[model samples]
Target chain A: MDLHQLWTIVSTPDNVPIVLLLFVVPFYAWYGLRQAFANDRLIAQLEGNPEMAKTHHRKIQPFKAGWTREVHVWPYLLRIEFLAAIIVTVILMVWSITLNAPLEEPSNPTLTMNPSKAPWYFLGLQEMLVYFDPWIAGVVMPSLIIVGLMVIPYIDANPLGNGYYTYKQRKFSILTFIFGFIVLWVSMIVIGTLIRGPGWMWFWPGTTWDHNRLIFEVNRDLPDLFGIAGRAGKIIFGAVVVGAYFLAAAVLIHKLITKTAFNRKIYARMSVLQYVTMQVFLIIMLSLPVKILARQLFRIKYVWVTPWFNI
Target chain B: MPETNGNDGKPAPPAAPAAGNGNGAGNGGKVAAVVAGAKAVKTRAVEEMKGAIKAPEKTDLWKSVLRVKHDETPRSRALGVLSNVFLHLHPAKVNRDAVAYNYTWGMGGMTFYVYITLVFTGTLLMFYYHPSKVVAFRDILYLDSDVPFGKLLRNMHRWGAHLMVIMVELHMFRVFLTGSYKKPREFNWVVGVLLLVLTLLLSFTGYLLPDDQLGFWAVTVGTNMARATPLLGHGGPFGPQMGMTPFNDVRFGLLGGSIVDSNALLRAYIWHCVAIPIIASAFMVVHFWRVRKDGGISGPAPVVLESEIKEPRKI
Candidate 1:
């Protein structure tokens, strides 16, 4: 594929992290090279003669910039701005040359692409939106997760492992995070692609939910009919679902191996193991699960009912 | 103090006069012991110096400062500059194993670099970026269409930002995969988690500034999604029925009305351009600060600094 098509795919939903990866490889290479050839010339000078070295900035040759001493300083972030300038200049030239890439048929407000994916980076969420309504899929889950993410530093009061923690020291939370991240992401992709359009529908129909549709139809309709009980059930169900998965793995193992009476510990341990294992399975299943899911969703050309959100 | 027989050419001690008092030789022994002790301390320090340079990020700032004279290389300047508050604060060395992840692979370091690149290009973009979405896209268009390096800087920052988000997510994935979010580091992990949220918020808010059709819908869908949660008895599914809470009207509150109007744009602009950056920066400071305070970024395996772990001297 030529650069234009490549850029579009990079900018849009392929669920591949090539764009970020591409940027990073060069960055670290530069980092390592700078570390090897580059001396902390400024730092060294500063120390060699702190008072007299106020003259270190002048040490840089006027155009010694043939290839080095690159770094950026702003927003309080110190990066290889000087080197970055060169790379960016080159990339920009290339991008500008390819900027003429034809825009896909103008996005018609009325006619939506069958599976109009979100900007590739956001396909994670677009992938999520499919499983949820505009509210849950699009907003609440992301908001909560993001908000929860914000609270992590505050809630994590431990001061032990800054750089690294031992195996035994970091068991529960690590496993939980991995399990939760995978389950949430993968499940969302599933719902977005697989569950989003058993029938194309929306979460709310003017403030009222049509419960009948959720069972035979897509999950978007489920939100419209969200009764207090159902919402509560979902919250509890999530816990149960997690707990049950753990339960399944263990009890199954116990049943197969040693016939022992089940207890809370057994159940909890089994459930935890089960969830973690499932997460691994899930992770392996799809490096870009959203893409696979999205393509699948788009493949279905016919729908019995039109979705309210309508692409 | 015993005087040897004059059989050999050995000098006789003053044993005849002060043989009973062993103070003279004792003083000499004490002096020798002191010299050995001092030598030991110096040796230990040199070893510590070597270890510090090898992994500068783990070394204390002042110690690293004291040790700089030893690092005679010119390239270390960049690595040295990394620790500069105003420059790249990368440690003199990094532990690769620390950044590896089992889940989504090694996205942590990549994301950090993404942030670095974003910060780099962002400064350039800020030179000409207007906070007004009304004119934000126009300004960007002008940068691309007219300004010599405007499009370059804009594209760099834009792509860099996107790369940052992806990297951050991947970082989180790596952290998860490797189970790095364990107990002791949980606190830092939590802070990192906040940083990630800030990253996402920063991105979402930024999308609105472009004011393109795509940008508008992205915000629309994002805000509407907020109404889905079971929070504060608002519009979330469980809340009271029709038009219950004022905030329940997701479309109205999120967009400052029923549509993605100018107000929404302004809010997004302020958030993306000003508010979010400030908040993220604050957290980043705390995050890095904690890295020093907390176990100082775990080094691979338990390799003790030879200087600090010197063997006892011969008796």
Candidate 2:
């Protein structure tokens, strides 16, 4: 194991945020989930004792008789805000003083940066380029992600867990979000930043980045794997395979959505349009991980390939 | 003469008599009269000054500026937030539990704070920076080696940007996890998503200002993706059939040319320094206003039990 190699990647000024992210994301995730589980416990308690539920102050936060429900923003909320701002300023000042921003040589278009990367945030999209065509990965996926996020409130018909964190209350929506954000978005960014090295090749953490390293693995398309040779036959085979995958995913998701009585109630609340939109987004989202698995495990390059585009 | 002055309704009887006796005694008496008058005036001035210092808020100037009393009373505290231009974004009061760091995580407020710092450092960086390729790199080098705190300035701007992006993502995550985007908050959430896009664009644009290899290559990789924007990009599917080309495509519009060149630098500079900030600020205004209009922070609200699930409202 090349400890120096790991340090080099981790300590690079630009990579620092991703390194920070590795810690920050998990910490916050645990922090949020802790509250969620706590609330879940409280929710279970309240459910069992309907008499107490009617009288109990529903929040896990401590409360007492004759206490004010609200407090002045001036000292209560504004003080915290002021303190937070001061803390942030100190952190930024310290960060700025210690670490200089990365500056490479002057622009020379003739000489290209090996494994040139988009900004760290866009690195997730850049990583997608490996599994899909540029149009789909770069353009379509990003547009869909933004649109899907915007439509979430309109689509989510579950009225429980509206103002508080509770894993049991919002199991489906919470899990779906965690999968999308932490798994797909953040994890991909981490992979793009740390694992993908020179020549955009995967290098395990602590492994030396060998610029000359090559993997002589054959990657095949789905149609080719199925022994389809003719142009028309290949196109038809790919279409059928992609269509089958979607249909299967839809069935599985539907089953999960209606599995519990609570889930069914939530599912029933969704209008037809909301249901369809949610399914389309979920299927598309699921395809990302499925495609990643296909490429990594089976060396499958494209599941569906056409004259103009490939997925 | 002092008694005669007293008859004229003068309250300073002691000072008047002393002055009158001094005047009768000639020039030395006149000096004594002046000294006595000065002593009385000083005592009265000190009393008035002490009263003013003790209750400055009662002064007309203070009242005009603050437009309200600022005592420890709850009414004054409420007015403290409601009366101010900046603090007015917030309501006079908030849910007691909402003020705790656990519920909100303070990410939204922190993100805004970081953005303010970015704008500050960015404005300073612009004073030393020129968008042209010829001097851009040299200017950065000059900033590092010569200009006072210029290196610090650039570093803060750069890191603060990355921090802002991180904070925005976290804020969104917290909002989602807490289910804070339900019902009336749905539109504000949409506004927030737009702001997120604008934040990314702002940072991406700023990446190229240094004209360094890191930025050049990163931007090259970025805009190259634009070239594959299906219908509009020249290299995208059906782009050729629809008359898209390298010279007249989405990528070309973004870069102001076929490649990342002088024009690209200028465009990035303009967008980074001017356009996107304005757009993001406009969205933020609506986002914050809606947060207030939609029933304040979405709570540490009383948890709803599963059995209490209301029937779906029929359209």
Clash-forming residue pairs, model 2:
none
What is the alpha-carbon lDDT for the whole of candidate 1?
0.48
Model 2 spans > 4 angstroms off = B1-48
Candidate 2 lDDT at B174 equals 94
In model 1, which regions exceed 4 Å deviation?
Answer: A1-121, A133-136, A143-311, B1-113, B123-134, B177-179, B231-235, B240-251, B302-315
lDDT of 2 by residue, A59-95 (tens): 9999999999999898989989999999999999999
lDDT of 2 at B210: 94
B1-315: candidate 1 lDDT, tens digit per residue: 112233233333333324233343587766655655555445555556656676775667956564343363645554455545644444443333332232123354456556666677666766766766446667667766788877666655665566577667656654443334544466788788888878977877776666666666556556655555444324555544544464446555666765566778777777776788888889888887776566444432221111222332333
TM-score of chain B of each: 0.60, 0.89
Candidate 2 C-alpha error for residue A165, in Å: 0.6
- Deviation (Å) of A152 in candidate 2: 0.4
State the C-alpha RMSD over the true interface residues for candidate 2, after superposing those residues: 0.7
Fraction of the true interface contacts (Cα pairs closer than 8 Å across chains) found in each model: 0.17, 0.87
Q: Work out the TM-score per prediction.
A: 0.51, 0.95
Backbone clashes in each candidate structure, one number apiece?
38, 0
